[model samples]
Target: MYENMDKEYVLNTYPRNYVNFKQGKNATLFDDKGKDYIDFTSGIGVSSVGHGNARLADALSDQVHNLIHTSNLFLIEPQAKLAKKIAELSGFDVGTFFANSGAEANEGAIKLARMYGEKKFKNKRYKVITLEHSFHGRTITTVKATGQDSFHKSDFSPYPDGFSYNKDINDIYNSIDDETVAVMIELVQGEGGVEPFEKEEVQKLAAFLKSKEILLIVDEVQTGVFRSGEFLATNLYGIEPDIITLAKGLGGGVPIGAVLTIHKDIFEVGDHGSTFGGNFLSTRAGCEVLDILEGYKNSGELDESFIYFESKLQEIAKAYPALFEKVVGLGLMRGLRCFENVDLSTLINRAFDQGVLILKAGRNTLRLLPPLTISKEEIDEGFKRLDNAFKVLS
Candidate 1:
């Protein structure tokens, strides 16, 4: 009934599955019909901690009872606390602006980058360099920034210029001109399939960009919040990015986005703002998420979880070599690259049918991003279901 209602009233934007998930706990989701499905996608990496998280729920509940929202004009405590926490965790003296989604975070990053470039360079250094198969957002400017041709539809004609696509470092270096201000990249291209950049390559790029005064913006929307076994993916590469955009898992499940301006005061007064961003509720949630993740990290639970998840994925990859050609990803954010002959679409459908949720990416890849708080037992069960699903395909 809700699915039909969605089709009739809601905008036909996302190509969605027919499952009506009613509730979830830890790493499992239950559809409206009461069938349980192991959530390997984590709602596309948004549910970092987990679903129905007691800590987050309790914190938000208390927050809602006390205060819900005010505005950017006034001082908000949760927002302040979250900003401080993020700045400290980010490993940089940073200023943070909050928004409501990953797209908004990326948009803010782009704006700050453009402003900084023009101010420092004394020219219109507004052009940005993104990579092929990169997806920034659905907004007009961000979609234009996206490198995929499928997203550049004729419907949204007259695209905003100053964005270019490059495949490799040579192409990026060659493409960088006087007008180019920044090169935005995802350390692990989550949506482009779970592809991670070489650590040395990223360091080289950072060094070159620093030499040329081109800011490096790291989009940690899908890969942040311990998704890649680190606080930020940039930490894995040992690079200090000029700007970092975060959403998805920052608030665990709340709709919140953050743009951290590191190394300097980039955005001045009246530069950029958001209405409902960093509200009382979302900030409380974000604080709880940080506390929870920090607790896990201190107890050595985070490290153990990362290692265990990778081993489980390795087990599956070895079990079904033909179906899962290789396990490719950073930490818990992983993918199973399917062989050419494997029925990718059918396997996805079968996984759903077998009560295991998953996602697809790239040409033929099974993207797996389970909750950071997911238990080893849940991982085993999820894979047990996946193994059965693969057998059906065989």
Candidate 2:
């Protein structure tokens, strides 16, 4: 019924799987026909605390009854608390601007960067440099910011100006000029095939940009909130970005995005605002996610889980050397790099039909973004299903 209704009513934007999931718990999902599947994608890394977490459900329900949204015109307590918690966790005196999604969060970051550039360079600087193959967002501006042309090829004509891609430090140096305001990058280019930048190179780039007074914007939309085994990937790389954008797993499956900045005074009043950003319910969910992660961190469970998951990925790579060339990414955000000739889409579809849900990163990368709260048994089951899929594919 849902598939029929969706076909009739919804726009065909995504090439969706055949299954219509009706329920989920932890790392498991149930389709409408009651078939159970091990979930490795974590709703594209949004359900960090896992599906149907009772604590999050209760918090969201309570918030819904009390308040769902109170505009940015008024100060909301939950929003304030969540912001404070994020600041504390960030280890910096920072301010946050909430948005509805990663794209919006990144859009906010870009605007803030442009505004700061205007003030610092007397309106002479507005250009923002991003890395090659980086995926920022879907908005017109962000599509231009995205380094890949394939993403912006559909009706994205006359690309926005002031955004350029660089493949190396020399390219970046050549791109920089008096009008350069910021350099944006994803430490791990998640959608670009789970590729990570070299730590030393990133450090040198950040230092060089700082020397030129250019702001560093780190898009942590996929790598933040313990998804990378660290609270933030920037912390993992020891790079302190002037601005950071976060979303995916921060709200524990709830839709929320945030722009966090070390330089809080970059934007003043009347500079930015969002109608539904940091509303009561979303902030409540965000706070609950933080609370759950904090508890896990205090109990050392998160670290143990991270280690176990990484080791299992390494084991898989070693075991399936004929199929998988390598494993990339940090913590739970991992990718199994398939052999060059492998059809990753077919493999992912086969895995789905075999009662496992995974994702594709680039052309030959099978991405796994299991929930942080997923258990060892769930991980084992997920991998077992994946192996079964591989056997059928072979």
Which digits, one per residue and each the tens of the lDDT, describe model 1 over residues 19-39?
Answer: 888899999999888999999
lDDT of each: 0.88, 0.89
Which pairs of residues clash in candidate 1, taking residues 3 or more apart in a chain or in different chains? none
Candidate 2 residue 228 C-alpha distance from true site, Å = 1.1
- Alpha carbon deviation, residue 257, candidate 1 (Å): 0.8
Off by over 4 Å in 2: none
Clashes of 2: 0
Query: Model 1 TM-score?
Result: 0.97
Residue-level lDDT tens digits of model 2 in 311-380: 8788767877778999898888889999988888888888888899989887479899999999989988
Candidate 2 local distance difference test against the native:
0.89
User: Which residue pairs does candidate 2 place in steric collision?
Assistant: none
Off by over 4 Å in 1: none
